[model samples]
Target: MEANKFLDAKGLACPMPIVKTRKAMNDLLSGQILEIHATDKGAKNDLTAWAKSGGHELVKHEEENGILKFWIIKG
Candidate 1:
């Protein structure tokens, strides 16, 4: 997916990915998408839940070569 911002949170753990994702999302306008690349396994669930709770949309996600990629559309 095309995103307005790209956040590389690779090599980070747990809450750090979510923390950075939140901060990056804050910089986006409503409807803009933030693409996040993280290595933390927990980020999959955490980011999905965070986006839902924040009224954002989790457009898509995938894991490749030990990396987790997420696309979140700002609400």
Candidate 2:
């Protein structure tokens, strides 16, 4: 899917990916999508829960070559 913004959180650890994703999401209008690329193993779970808790939609996610990609739409 196309995203309004892309965030590279590849080298970031736990809270960092979510932190950056949150900040990036804040800059977008409702229904816009934020695409995040992260290498941290824990980011999948962290982002999934964070998206739900924050009322955003985790529209799509995938793992490729050890990198985790997520597409989230701001609620």
Measured by TM-score, the strongest candidate is 2
TM-score of each: 0.96, 0.98
How would you encode candidate 2's per-residue C-alpha lDDT over 1-75 as one tens digit per residue? 999999999999888999899999989999999999999999999999999999999999999999999999999
Model 1 over residues 1-75: C-alpha lDDT tens digits? 788999999999877998888899889999999999999898998998999999999999998999999999999
How much RMSD separates candidate 1 from the native structure? 0.6
lDDT of each: 0.92, 0.95
Flag clash pairs in model 1: none
Q: Which regions of candidate 2 deviate over 4 angstroms?
A: none
54 Cα displacement, candidate 1 (Å): 0.5
